[model samples]
Target: MNLISKLILGGLITASLHANAMIIRHDVSDGKYIQQAADYPAIFPLKDDGKTKNCVGTLLTPQWAITAAHCTILLEPDSQLEIAGNKAKVHSIHLPPEYGYMKAIKNEQGKIIDIEDKVKDASFDIALLRLSHPLKGVQTFPLLEQKVNVNQTIEVMGWGDFGNGLEGVSRKERVNDRQLRVAHNKIDAINGNYLIFNFDAPDSKNALPLEGINGPGDSGSPALIKLPNGYFVAGISSGGDYPGVQTHKREGKYGWQEYYININAMTAWIAETMALSITKN
Candidate 1:
């Protein structure tokens, strides 16, 4: 269980480091309303083998979609983007110049000693996908440039396994069939290139009606905020952890924090990459 394995095989594992959770709320009874259908068509799933959707992506352009770099490892030649029940072929996958695995420095006996930090110790986890053809009629979202303030509310949408905070995201609560869900959370903090959201208990004053955080199979989904003009993507789903909780419990529990790759901080790289990708296409 090194960093490489976590990032490479995370999507297939229940609690891998790179596996982003589905939206889990404090109110389990609201599951019916929290589930969505055909909403946020711009956010779609990335199939791992042309069959199973292990990660999700956002439609930045008709011809371009963005996702986590770690997901690229599981994508196959026949991997397709499932959008509104239609599929688009992936022409190419592009990683940022900074994209690379974080390896732990080991001792002579292979016990880990030190770790390397890059891009502020966060994985440059973003990636871009070039589609073989432009997606017709689907709406696209713009990346947020202005800094998002702490305590501002944002929406998270994706297709994955979900459950209530009381039982967490494991066991029978995790559905085999992925469903589209949207949840809201306020920005707890901003750490380097990541946006942090904590899953507040239903009784907590900070909890929203559908308060939730990311969970398994939500990797690469977008944390969005709507402005007067339209919706803007502020962060990409990355990973989460339960701070100071020693239960070693499954993810998506109450008090757990979800980390999203801050899209605002990576707008420069995203814009540059999209421009270059379009030219190549």
Candidate 2:
């Protein structure tokens, strides 16, 4: 892939790079999540290295990008999410109004003890970014106007690692092996504020053979819907649950439930934020 030529087709459905990092792995080790890369300029890869956090971001317009709120923080005025051999300097960030952060309370052993208190509103995990420069050439995706109907097929892409198994791996391990991968699944449920997609594994006899599902480091991946008119951004990869009851456990049947920030629910916020970005410049 000639990197720069990686055009975001219509709305970033196809990958400019044939082979992207695997979004998720179902089988044990060496499992392949996605077969190819989603050759789209907006398909950003995520990497959270504590010192600096990384997450996927989609170019909605020349001057604006969208991503997950928890993917990163509002930097101290002058930093950017470096991605795709380029950097989109952060001009401003707009998070959901109801969103609030809870500091992680860690014990003497350094283990986070207050899981519940640190929980934020997962419903409005979406955030919009005003970039210092416009991503040239690639087609920017528009937010979906209508409500997402059930059974609607949606495409998701990210650079998540595969094969965390039931004992899902850590962000550091995933970042080491992450690749830009793409997969598709139908909307299984709607939570008013989210688009719930069920990503089944290849081993699941009765479920859809969706190759991959969102995993750690895929927080800001775009949930794209192919409308009759064109492709649109319907959801942002807010979070997901894997198979088995054990939380954060990797593997088992795909049975991954992915939650995306309902784009329609934040329509006004998106516009208001983008407009504000323009005013800033």
Best by lDDT: 1
For residues 1-281, what per-residue lDDT tens digits would candidate 1 score against the true structure? 43423433433433332233455554455564355655677877775433335677888778788887765654644566677666788888777766664344557985435444332233567888888788788888768878888999998866545666876766234463455678889999998877888989988999988787767767788888989987888888776667655345466778888778887788888788778767875
Candidate 2 global lDDT: 0.58
lDDT, candidate 2, at 149: 85
Write candidate 2's Cα lDDT for 1-281 as tens digits: 11101111100221111112334444533433343444566665444443322457787877777887655432423565654456667777677666643233457985434322222455766777777887665567888888788888888776534443344444334334444556667777887778877656556553444545555445677888877776789888766654344344232235656678888888988888777768777
- Which residue pairs of candidate 1 clash? 20-215, 21-214, 21-215, 21-216, 22-215
Each model's number of backbone clashes?
5, 19
Give the per-residue Cα lDDT of candidate 1 at 123: 50
Report model 2's TM-score to 2 decimal places: 0.71
Instruction: Quote each prediction's TM-score.
Output: 0.81, 0.71
After the best TM-score superposition of candidate 1, give how far the Cα of residue 179 lies from its true spot, in angstroms. 2.5
Stretches off by above 4 angstroms in model 2 are 1-38, 46-53, 74-76, 82-86, 102-120, 164-178, 201-206, 228-230, 242-248, 251-253
Q: For this target, which candidate reaches the highest TM-score against the unseen true structure?
A: 1
Cand. 1 Cα-lDDT: 0.69
lDDT of each structure? 0.69, 0.58
